[model samples]
Target chain A: MDNPNLEDLLIACRQGSDDAFRKLFEQYHMRVMSTAYRMCGNIQEAEDVTQDVFLKAFKEIKKFREAASLFTWLYRITINLCIDKERKRQRRQKYHENVDVDSERITIEEANSNENTRTLDQQMWQDEIQSILQKALSRIKPKFRTVLVLKDIEGLSYEEAAQAVGCSQGTISSRLNRGRKELKTLLVKMGMGEEYFQER
Target chain B: MKHGFTQKNLSAYLDAELSPDKVQKIELHLQSCESCLRELQEIRSGKAVATCFENPDWQDTEALWQNIQRLNISTPEKGDVKNLEMKRTNLWQRLIHPRPAFAIAVLLILFGINLFSNLKQKKFQYQRVQLDQELSYGFDYGLYLDALVAGSPAIEFERRYESQQASYEQARSQTTFRLASFTHMPKTFQLREVRLLKNACCRSVQFSCLENSREVIIFQQPQGHPVTFGNYPLERIELNGQMYHRIKTGKWTVLSLQLKESQFMAIGEMNESDIAAIIFAITTI
Candidate 1:
């Protein structure tokens, strides 16, 4: 949609119009849900975070200044919520450390069985690669992980990433560098061959 | 060229975040640097791996929106759009143009300090008035005597005796020291009232005499008791082998003398000679 049209839609949403809100959700829900999924490493949590983001955006639509684009604002909220969810997950992991080991082993076995049943195809291979990437991404710290997700995965420019992260462009550049190095090291350590990353 | 490029520079160059000149310099350095090129390739591979993780299609957009709408229904609305827009504009203006906001914050802080100091001063004044009232009613004898001799309004006595003999008897009964009485009286001055006074500092008997419109008071207390009253300078004089300390305050004269076991003070608007004569005529008998 054009800028003026988006502005009008935002105004309508601010006026407590449910139709405008639904239109906004239709327009950006994919991107929001996708980013949430990458950040959370799970579809369920991504859906939950996406719902929370839209609800918060709807409620705070009035406070939305025109200084930033709507997408940037939504992304900022998504990143914050994702980080909060990550922290809670970490706390839960610590609480159920012993219980989590068995569950994690079962999940890995199930994933192997599912993969064995799938026909060897490009789509399945891509999905497997995506899953492995997500696991590595989740292993990295949230600060660097967010930068990588925004810059590499989501393809946001450094300026846009800086705005979404509420930081300077220099900080974004620095974090992106570290995040790339850490992700590369983690992928190599995960025994993913260098050929997997070779351009198809 | 020797160091090629730092990881940060290479990363920023890959993202096209660096300035054109820096990007040109790094590009030139990369041509001659094999290790940096290898590192750059590794970073590219990482980026490629990350980019391969495309956004999984979310099929539950409608369900999620419904859930969001349901949640939004329960949450209270902040305000109408127009009011919120105005507030947002004001907030943005404050952020974008901070000088006015800073000036207003300073003014508010100054106003708060002024208000606090005024309240503190008022509280201090109130406490001082309360303390003065308590001291007066508590019969601070020194302050009362000072006020009387200075011709200011003295604190009221707790009890007044109808007759001089009755007051003298009460004074003698209440005190351990020998009480002195007037043997001879001045013809012009007639006794008016007598009061017994006591406080934390000391206890004394007060005799009030009236000479027409003017008044005189005599106080008798135990010798060596502490006095907490005026800051007046004293003059000493010997009359009939009795040493008297005299102080003049405003129009009133105070004459004090130590007898055998008691201290007697006469306060009145009288000449020095008359007060001295009154003191000499008083005896323990």
Candidate 2:
């Protein structure tokens, strides 16, 4: 949504209009949900991040500066939550690895459960390729993955993505290059073959 | 174009984030250098591959909207109410869980203040007794009257009398009074008892009558008792060549008469007409 209408909605929301809030939720929930899914790699976590972002946005709407677009603010919140969730998961995993003797079995069981969820036919080329890409994407560092997801996957312009990620356009450019190279190397390692990256 | 452009520029060129001039320079370089062209193709393909992470289906949107609604509803508006709530909560928290040193200091300060006030009140009680004796016309009656009224000694006396009514009753029964002095009281006012003031020299007789449950007190001070009724706006009325002083203090109007040995002061909530009648009746005795 355009800033003027969004600014109007924000003003109305600040003036305590439930209708304006509902309109804002309707307008941004999809994009916020999509960006969260791209960043977190799961529908459930993405929904949680989406809800958190909008709830945060609603609570802090009075603090929202007109200089920044509403989506950029929402994107920043969603990104932070995703990063926090990822860090907490990593910490828990590290702790479990240290204390839990059956950590290896637990990891295998988690993998099996994840595999079980993707019961989509492997014969479908798009689903199979996309599933492999999702796994490779999750394997990359979050800093690079975020830049790549915002720029390449979510299709935000470099300037918009920079604003969303709280970085300069030049940094977005550099990170996109590093992220693309890492993803390409990961895909090749996963037997997608070099030819998969050669075509435009 | 000098080194076939860097990978950062190549990525920017693919993203169309670079300036048009930079884009043209990179495109021309890509055309001249087959390796640069192949690398651009690789970056483009990789970018496309990354786009394969499709957005999952949105779920629980109603629940999320409800949550957002709840958040908005629960948020206090930007006003004094929100600040007041935060301040109230902070005050409540501090009050309940005060720091040990702070709580101790507060308790000590409060105890000191209470102790100091109690000591001052005890001093005032003693001073009040001195001021009451000085209320009789002797030296600087205005200053002593102002001090008495300002300190409100009457309220203190009332408080003491209420607390020690039985003690006052015992003192009243033990006290002796002249039977002829009893004639100074009016017929409507029944003489309850004669009680001694704290100063053993001063005595007061209490009288009660069923005139709207009113009671009168007559202070009968001994002869030449250094006490005078001179401070009040007294009207000198010579009844049958003997002088009487009529005065009003707050709700009670007093009729005072000086005899050869003692001063008699009668005080009651009696009206002007009733006061004249009582004065006339008391003086005739």
Candidate 3:
């Protein structure tokens, strides 16, 4: 999977070597899908973003220089594309097709059923914590959500998050703060304060 | 500090982004203030929950997608309509306004392109045979083999030749070749084409060989010396069981050699059969 020649293969691809380009695409296709899926938080949207990123990358790869590693370049592109899609998503009201009902209720039911074999306290608390977190995450704006994902989830630094979204570090720093604060507010509302928010 | 901090500033403090002075101030304030500290803890927990989404089982689809790329197959089976129509695209329109026809067309073109490229032999043949027919070209080859490995030059004349990128309508281009000999060969170095300035900088003589589908590129960069890509001389040497030509002076390596029509560079190392097959492929083309 870690073929050092992947970059060289990409160069050949940009040079119109169809064979080389195919190899490059195959090597990174799933990783790109994984990243997109994680960022978008939905299977279909993830698939769509993955398809879009690769298509866009294929078109613009000729302009890609060795200024950045190929994975970094692709990572930056995927995040940007997803962020763009997300902003647009916010403008239009979004509804989850499958999980349209109260997510917390569904999670509680699922948790209760799954934890039947276990003692009730541990199972109940786990379900309660998860539902609280999920509901809270759904309330934040996409910008903050993106920063949260990249930083906490993807573990990117402020500068890297900024570069991915085409913003200044100051913006990322601020947005991340805003996101964390919102999460805290939501968590406090859910009464999961001590379990999850004790150290925030 | 009166408001304690903005939501963002407090969050940043939790993330440890504040400098020493700022960090100290935030810590002092948060230590005394239970409300903000509680908010901070909540935010951190929420942030941790979000990590669950970070690394999902995207790996399951990895194989499926890799196969897609390997097969170079676009399932939608639609011709590219965007490039066909020549629609406009930029951040502004792409963001607020997406051209479905244009976007889909662009997507279609891209998908088609990928489908063609990834269709290596292992995957489904798909439409590759048809696409390959469109892209494939005839080959005519030249052998500096006669002169590829010979002597070394001290004073070298290097040249970066002209290059052209082909378009969809024009996938194939004729290759050009030239050869010249010098009094001495440089020890071992490749002439770089990547950093050359606009002008051809060598004292070049004008000459042309019979036109063919092969290009034998020998270029060099001499410290404190000027070289040109025109008709400069070349030399050859056999080093470590492989033959390389040093054309026209010091520190030149074979930049690249192309064989046309169903042929490939043995890449960095080649045996006799590979070399002969390369020649055969070019000749057959």
Each model's DockQ?
0.31, 0.26, 0.19
Among these predicted structures, which one has the highest TM-score?
A: 1
Could you tell me the lDDT of residue A117 within candidate 2? 46
How many pairs of residues collide in model 3?
30
In angstroms, how far off is B169's CA in candidate 2?
Answer: 67
For each candidate in the order shown, give its overall lDDT on alpha carbons.
Answer: 0.67, 0.62, 0.49
Off by over 4 Å in 1: A1-4, A95-125, B1-5, B31-35, B78-285
How is the predicted docking of candidate 1 categorized under the CAPRI scheme? acceptable
Candidate 2: tens digits of C-alpha lDDT, residues B249-285: 6655566777766666565556655555555544543
CA deviation > 4 Å runs, candidate 2: A1-4, A95-127, A193-200, B1-5, B31-38, B71-285
Total clashing pairs for each candidate: 0, 1, 30
- Superposition error at A55 for model 3 (Å): 1.7
TM-score against native, each model: 0.53, 0.49, 0.45
Ranking by DockQ: 1, 2, 3
